[model samples]
Structures are given as C-alpha cells and as structure tokens.
Target: MSATVSPDQLPLQRLYHWERTAPNRVAFTQPVGGGQTVDYTWKQVVDQARRMAAHLQAQGIGAGDKVAMLSKNTAHWMMTDYAIWMAGAISVPLYPTLAAGTIRQILEHSEAKLLFVGKLDGWLGMKPGIPEGLPCIHHPLAEADAKKSYPGWDDIVAKTAPLAGEPVRPADDLSTIMYTSGTTGAPKGVMHTFANFMAAVAAGLERIPQNEGSRMLSYLPLSHVVERALVEHGQLQTGMHVYFAESLDTFTTDMQRARPTVFFSVPRLWVKFQQAVNHKMPQKKLDTFLKIPILSGIVKKKILSTLGLDQCIFAAGGAAPMPAELLAWYSKLGLNIAEGYGMTENIGASHITTGDPDSFGTVGRPYAPVQCRIAPDNGEIQVKAPWNMLGYYKQPELSAEMFTDDGWLKTGDKGSTDAQGRLKITGRVKDLFKTSKGKYVAPAPIEDKLVMHNAVEACCVTGANLGQPLALLMINAEATAVVKNGGKAELEASLAEHLKHINETLDPHEQLDCLVITSEAWTVDNDLITPTFKVKRNRIEDMFAKNYDRWVGMRKPVVWHG
Candidate 1:
C-alpha cells in the first residue's frame, strides 16, 4: 500500500530500481558556464553513482564510514551523495559558503574522514580546513584557479572501479549526519536513517503532484535536507527532469526555460520575487488598476511574466517567516506559493501550508505522520515523529537537551495553533531581542515585513543600548546590475523609495529608525548570514557598531554608507 518499496531496502536500492524502470529518462540537468543547462538520464546517473559507490568501497568506505561533502549544488554533488549511501556510509554535507572556522568546527565535530570539494570561490584556501588525504574533489579546470592547488575530484572518481559487488546497505542504517546551525551556540549533528529520507519523500509528494512527467527546478543548495529529500529522492522514483540555475545571475532566465511545475525557495528569495513584481508596477499603480477591474487582468498578467511565475503550480517558501501581504499578492496572480516552517533537526520537512486557499497564513497542519505540540511553559514547538533525528553525532550533553525525557524533539521556535489546527509560528523563542528598556522584540516577524520592499534585497534587525531600531539592508544586485552603465542617480532614487515604503508599513515601535545600506553582499562566509540564509544578528551589529552614528546623521529616512 505504500508508495515506496519494502522498508527493509536502502535508498540506493530504490535508486537502482528506478534506473531500470526509466533508463533513458533525465535525472539531473546542471548548468554549464554561459547560460546553458545540461541533462543526465536516470540510468546514466545510477550507473555512475554505483560506480562511484564501487570506487568508494575500494577506498575502504563501507558501512559505518562517514564521508563528508563540501560542495555547491551540482549533479555531481547529488550523485556522490547517493554513492555514499549506496556504499552504506553516512553522508555528511557541509554548506559550501561556511567560514573556515565553522567548517573546521563541523568537520571536527562530525569526525568526518573524507571530504569532497566540488567548486569553490577564493575562500576555499583558508586555513584550518579539511586536512590532506581527506580526498578533496574539485570541478574541472573551469572552476579551478591554477595558483590554488587542491586534489581533483575527477582523479578520485576515475580511480574507482566502474563495477563492483553490491554493498550491504540496510534501510535502518544511518544515512546522513546533518549538522544544524545553532542560534545560541555551536551547531549539532542530527542523524537520520534511510527510512527517514524515504518516508519524508512519500509524505511530501502527498502535498504536490510530482512524478516522472513533472519537472523540478532546484535553486536551493543540496546540503539542505528538504531540497535533498524532495529533489534527490523524488528524481530516483520518478525519473523527473531536474534543472539547475545557470548561475545566481541568470536564475530568472533559467526558470522560464525550465518552466518548472514543482519549485522550492527560501522565504528571503520568495520575498524578493514578489518585490520584483511590485517594482514594475508600484503598489499605488496596482491598487489603482485593480479598482478598474478591466485593466487589472492585463496588468497582473504582464507582472507575472516579469517575475516568471506564469505557470508554476507547486511553488513553496520555507526556512523563515513569509509575510501575509506578499503571499496574498502572488496568490492573486494564480500562483500556488505556500509558506512552510521547518528546522534541519527534523530532516527539514515539517508543517507546510496546503494548496487550499484557507491555509494561507498558517504553516498548514502537520503531516499525518508528524505529531507536533506546543510546550506548556515557554511555548517551544515540539515534534514527535518517526522521521526525527536520533541525536547529535557525538555530543551527548547537547543531544539530551534537544529532546524531552518522554521523547519529544524540542524545537526552539515559538508558535500557536488555530481553531482548525493549522500551525502559525509566532516567532523564535531564541531570536527575540531585548531592547535597552528590556522590551522584547522578535526580529523574524519585523524582518519579514521590511524585506517585502523591492530594492531591499536582504536585511538584519538589531539594536543595542544606544541605537534606535537599525536595519542593515543589502540592495538588490540584479536590479542594480542593470541600472545600465551610468545610472547611479536612478539607482539611488529607487533605493530611497524602497526605504520609505518599508518604513511606512511598520508600527511606531517596530519601525526601522535607521537603515544601513551596503553594496557588499551578506553571505555565510562574511558571517552575515547562516547556511539556510538567515541573518546572523550579532555579527551584523558588530560590523556596523562604529559607523552607526554616521547613518543617523545623514538626515535621510534610511542610512546609505556604501
């Protein structure tokens, strides 16, 4: 009766079956250098994964071995992932953009033996990294810098036997050790089994109509569990077309070409996509046009084309809070953009907003298999599910703190349930900040409202003793990249308008008293954001502490220090 095979088989076993069933069908379509996406069939991918599995076993990687991967989102990345499980070793995924110190902490924490590096920017050379003989993998000469020397990925895969005996992979065996980013302290490794991965795939497919015929465009990093469980496992079962964005710059053009029926994105990217539509026809113009009723359809159609959400039915937003305003705006354009909430500890698939219109603001109800409860004392969300992680890899003290004695996984997010039982995440219990007056301000909800503004690409909310509500905002690079050669004045005016709009939408206390604009991007490396792309509040505040007064003196509605 289940959608998957016997629970006794490993995920790699399921993958081998899909290859036989749909041999020539496309498995993953990765991006090439200049505006091109390439495809690999299911059979070819499986054969390579098996060969890689064979090669890994030859290198002494068998059951219980932990193989760590630090790579960007690519076909080779996911293929190597299956190879690890196929060989019965646990997969340890490291965020490609993590700081060297953080990477060192995680690899050391997980006690990873082998690390495969796909392609990295300059930061890969930083010290205290994965040591030599760990077998670092890199892309061909294209992503490599001649000056920067490291082990090549091709040489290792080449050394692997093209064929080998079947590995003893079991369903209950540990499949991955996913390290979750900590809000208050160091990260922890969350262990998940092969059955957890497959069950999540089955449960997720119940929400959307995904199959071999359905196409998926994966923009999120493969390291994240939700992306991996859905895009990676679903492809093995369905022989679906999986296309990667050419580059972050050409993601929009890539979306249009892929014309994906099933798509997933983080809440931050979802907000920017909605804002892009608003910039084309400012809110005033849209309101005025909607009043006409006649021109509204035409105007909305044009706007949808610009945002490239013209034909996507299975669009989802996760990892952070999504504003009610932006969700309604896209819903009007006939997009099925729904909001969901989850943490890495749960294999990253949890409560999700349903396709039904009534399920709007709520993260919808929990999946049938997942039982969630609001804890009595501090309102921490707790999950009791079969797919829940076993414990932290080696930290018993941390692991004991994560669960109740009765077996509930304590999620630090604060939430409440509506009458219909749909879950609404009020805020994060840990992310709530105390003002100088000791008034608690939850930044997640406030940050959600501010990012709805078009020119505001990313923002972090912070205020210590002296400063009023200050937000460090990064301008939308894609929009500014095309302010054409000499359009600095126009870009400034647009950014000014965006700051004004965001300020007007907030309550008096929650209003951003000052805005810090910077051209330098906020990413995991610079320590401004997390692996899941959430802002690092402490780092942002420290970075701007000296220049905080200069922004307030500008007399502008917001600060522009770039």
Candidate 2:
C-alpha cells in the first residue's frame, strides 16, 4: 500500500490531461511591465510548449540532445522545460545567479546543443559564458540579451506549427540534468528521469495537501529541485494556479496578489521575515500583546495578512536547516514553518516536519516508500527512494561512490533519528571540523543558534586545528546602520551577551571561542553563498584561515570587528 503514482502518470502526461480536461483553467499568472499581470490557461501552456517543441525539432535537436536554459523564474521558463522534454531532449538548468565561469563550465560539461535565455538579471555579464558555437534562442522577456542577433522565442512560436503529438519517452528516460550549487566543492550534474520526478511528485502530493484550486507563489529559482517539485510538478499534479514574483522589489506585493495556499521558502528568507516583524514590533512588546487572548488573534491575523501568508494552509522551510527558536516564534503567530530535508540528488524528496508542535525541530518521518537510515559509523544519512537521481551525469566513478553496494544513495549529511523516526540533521559530513583538542564540532547547530540573534544576519562556525571553534558573523544591514549612527558600543555589548548565551547552551567542545564580526557581507555576488542561499563553507574557510589563529588567540568572547 503505497501512495506513489505510476510512471505513466508523469508530469508531462498530466499536463496534457489537464489541458484536455480544463483547457480554460488558469495555469499560470505572470507579471509583465508596469503593475500588471497576465494569465495563461492550461491550453495556452500546451500550445506554447507544443510550438516550442516543434521549433526545437525543426532545428534538428532530437531525442537525447541536451538543451540548456539560463533564466530567472517565469512562465516561459517552465514552458521551455516542457518543450525540451516534449522534443525528446534533456533539459539543463543554470541558476541566474551563477558567474560566467560556472555558467560556461555547466554548459560545456552538459554538452548542451541549444541554449535558451530568458528574463535574466545578469544576462549581459553571462553572455560571454555561452559557448561560441552553440545556437541560442532568446525569450521575449530577454530583450536586452536578444539584441545579440539570436532568433527570438516569439518568432519561433509564430513561424512553427504545434507539434502533432507529444513525443513518447520511457519512464527511465532522462528528463533533466541539474547541476549542484556546490557549497563544499565543485558542482556535479545530477541526472533525474521522468520516473524519478513522478515518484517525487506523487510522494510530495500525498504528504502536502493540494487540489485544483490550490495556489503557489514561484519565486525560488525553478532550477532548484524543491521549486521544481513543489511548484512546477505540483502545478501539473493538482492543476494549481501559479504566480511568479516579478523581482525582489515586488515580492511582497506579488505574494499578496497570489495569496498562496501552499508556500515554501528557504531558511534565510524566513529569518529576514522574522527580523522584519521584530523590527516593527519589538519581541517583548509582541509577547505582551499575545498574552491578551483577544489581541493575540488580531495580532496574528494582521501579521500573517501583511506578509501575505494569511491563506497559507502549509508553510515549509527547506534548502537549509531552520533555527528552532525561529520555528517556535512563528508558531506563536499560529504559522508553523515546518522544516523538510532533501538534496538535489534525491529530487528534494525525503523528510518533512509534521505540523504538530512536538515535531518542530525535527524533519519528520520519511515519505511513503522512501527509506532513510543513518550510517552506523559516521552518522551520515542514507536514503533509498524511487525519486533518487540515476547518477551524476558523465562521472561514472563519482556516481559509483555515491551509493553503497546495496544501493542506498549516500546523502553525505550527518543526522540521527528520534524515537518517532523523525530525522534531525546535525551537519554535513564534510562540514564537521576537528578542534586542536581532537573533538569534532558540527557547525550547523551552532550557526543556527548564532543566527537567532536579530543583529546576526549570516554566520559560519570554523576553527579547524584551533583550541575551539569560532563564529564568523555578519551583522544585519539595518543593525550595522544603527551601529554606524553612534550605536557601536551598545551593539558590541549586545553581541557579546548573545555569544555568552549561545555558548552556555553548547557542549564544551562545540562552544565557540570567539565571534569574529566580519565587515563585508557574504553574498552570492562575492561567492560567499550559493544561489540557494547556503553559505559557502569552503570559501569562508579560505578567506579566514590565515586570521583564524590570531582571532582565537585573542581569547575574547567576541571580536567586535574584523
């Protein structure tokens, strides 16, 4: 008795089924110039995908050929993905935030025969990364990049007829080759098939409730597996109406317009949201207001509505571990931000937190037919699921090493299971560092605790070969501005107190020796964070390795400045 759907019920087939059954139903609502939005029906999606598929076929791109898409999230992005598959080609997605070098590497490594550019913020900078011989197609939204003399996407759609019939692909046929945004090391392309996607979509739908009228806001890069599973595939499965965020500036207004019934976000964005609420209503004052039963309901409703999460039936946080304190705080507002655990290799399928209060800190039990177990030796979590990727594309040796002889995909994450079978991730196996005292320190939990402080925007704990670990902290922009305006001493003292509080709760070995407050913020532009918002631990270590000895030797509880 499993909830998993058969491969025959794949997303592409489901798309066609919905097109036939609900052709007029709104499939996507995309924002255009000005403050306007455009709606596309299921029929429109199929029509566009069909025409695009025909165009690809006309260009001699056939089955097994690789097609790459570099773009931000948009209706066209999803349509292009479908068209690639419909044309019997493998789709390769590149994150819009990637630098030209990484972009070039992925495109070359994947052997992409054709490239589609759409709605990118950095297309001008990334244009040089396109391999010279590869043909390019520019979406209408990519007008800036389109000036380079590539054929327009609209031109293809207008000139080509719709594909006569959907191309047949076996369940095991490769659907997409997704490159991992390497936080620890070099990126590797993870290959997933139509069957893998179907399995993930089926398991995810069973765990998270969704139906025809469900709404989702798609802002996270569709290149990521979580957005693909939850937003794209979720749309196909449930006939959900999707709304795309126009840009970072319009995210709030867009969220309000969508009023999404199911919302998902990474932990960094969730932390910012919490910090914003705290700025408006100080934590102490909010706590006092919540004590009044009548006022509590009003405060909660007002806060949720303003954040445009008032209609959210399910709110999930993933791509990184969420701080337990943040989860508790959201719970007080009657919005439980459940944490889920997965990686690109598994098509983002694994554990998800139950809405129950007791399950707050742990990623809940495995989804149906997905097995999870911790390695007895190093505590790495291993998974066996129908949704797991076939292997790392073009790296047979690396692929072979990803699984045990018995076939569980080695997740490379360190975690443990509770009595209720809930999984609590400690850190990545490669992320654990050893102190001079020979004790191993897992930075994730400690970093989570440090980021709970409102002033601390991002944090990394590293002290390899030192007496104890030290936290490299970045102050929030607002907090830094306050310090610049004569609040320096107060901010330092507050940070010191925060460090002491965090240290007291940690094990002796895990306690941070000092907090090094970094001047420059870590960001994707600077290569300090991945596109998915996970901190690049390797880069941080490289930047501070020389200063680590000096910082730890200072023997102060907090460095105040670095």
lDDT of candidates 1 onward, in order: 0.73, 0.89
Off by over 4 Å in 2: 1-8, 560-562
Against the hidden reference, what TM-scores do the models get?
0.87, 0.97
lDDT string for model 2 (1-562, tens) is 1124565488788888888899999899999979999999999989999999998998999999999999899999999999998999999999988888888999999999999999888677888898898999988778574646688888889888999865667778898999999797778999998888888888888889878889999999999999988898888888989999999999889999999999999988999999989999999999999999999999999999999999999999999998888899999999987788899999888999876679977898998888999999999999988777888999999999999989898988999999989998989999888999999999998999999989988899998888888999988888999988999888888889998998999999888888888998888888999998889988998888899888877788778554
RMSD of each: 3.8, 1.7
Against the true structure, whose lDDT is highest? 2
Poorest 10 consecutive residues by lDDT, candidate 1: 1-10
Candidate 1 regions off by >4 Å? Answer: 1-5, 8-10, 35-37, 123-128, 139-142, 145-160, 164-168, 286-308, 355-357, 464-468, 478-512, 518-520, 545-557
User: What would the per-residue lDDT of candidate 1 be over residues 1-562, giving only the tens digit for each residue?
Assistant: 1123365334666676766677887777877777656778877777777777777777788878888887777888888888887777888988777777778888877777777766455544543576545565554422544224555556656666555544546566788888776544577788888777777777777876787788888767778887887788777656678887666778788787777878788877777776766766678877888777778788777776666666666888888777777788777766767777677777667788875567776899887788889999988899877777777888788889989989888988899999998998878777667656656666767777667767677888777553356778886765567544676567667656766777687665566666677768887767777877777777777778777667766766655566
